[model samples]
Target: MMKTAVIYATKTKHSKKLAQAIGLFLDITVQNITENPVLDDVDLLFIVGGIYGGASMPELLAYIKTLEAPMPKYAALVTSCASGSQKQIAVCNILEEKGIKVLDEFVCKGRILFVSATHPNAKDLKAATDFAQKIVAGGLK
Candidate 1:
């Protein structure tokens, strides 16, 4: 079996929820990067998080810098204010700099956590899950 790991940072659980859905589809483990940073054992790594103020989370960036895993297949998922914008492109560039080969990138609209009373409703959740399936099927790559 192809071993896969979903490593992510989540503030309001939207990204985490998406990761979990992906993990279920791929039969892989879901790890929160804040609680864990070591990913040496994972064969395929899926980095999931949100784009905040045009960049990835600081903690996620730090973790990526410290990673020493063999150049495994890598992919990224993000909840963003605008999909496929400069922020997403920046994230892809950063991952490439870390020597992680980005296979595909997926993005979904996310409501500003503190500024919005409501966010990531059911429809958004479904979109995330569907995207996860696509990644697992190698359709995104």
Candidate 2:
């Protein structure tokens, strides 16, 4: 079986919760990037985070930069942002630059104070799980 890991760099807890849901779905533990977790030979990496000021957190991007080639051979992005637009292009680009194959992405509404406050709800969690399952099941490649 291919080894997989779920990691998140989150300002708000929404991304952490989404990572937790995906972790639970896949029976794996979710990691926080702020903790400076190191990955080793990960076959697939699920990078979960939120968009702040129209971009992914610098912390997340920096962590992604630290990842060298071949440890994470593949990646899937899971994002929580008010725009809900599969809009983590920076994250995608960095991973690709490192030669990590980004298979797909999952985005859902995230709370911005009163805006989208009800988001990352049950429906979003379910969709994130489904997306992860499809990636692990090789549905993306």
Compare the candidates by lDDT and give the number of the best one: 2
Q: What digit string (tens of lDDT, one per residue) describes model 1 on residues 15-126?
A: 8877777777667778898886566655567777877778788887777776764645566555544342434565567678877677766677666645433556666667
lDDT, model 2, position 54: 89
TM-score of candidate 1 versus the correct structure, residues matched by position = 0.77
* Each prediction's whole-model lDDT (CA): 0.67, 0.89
Candidate 2's C-alpha runs over 4 A off are 139-141
Model 2 per-residue lDDT tens digits across residues 26-93: 99999999888778878889999999888999888888888764568889999999878847899999
| Clash totals in order | 0, 0
RMSD of 1: 3.0
Which residue pairs does candidate 2 place in steric collision? none
TM-score, candidate number 2: 0.94
Instruction: Report lDDT (Cα) of residue 83, candidate 1.
Output: 44
Q: Give the number of the best model, judged by TM-score.
A: 2
Model 2 clash count equals 0
lDDT score for candidate 2 against the true structure: 0.89
- In order of appearance, the predictions have TM-scores of 0.77, 0.94
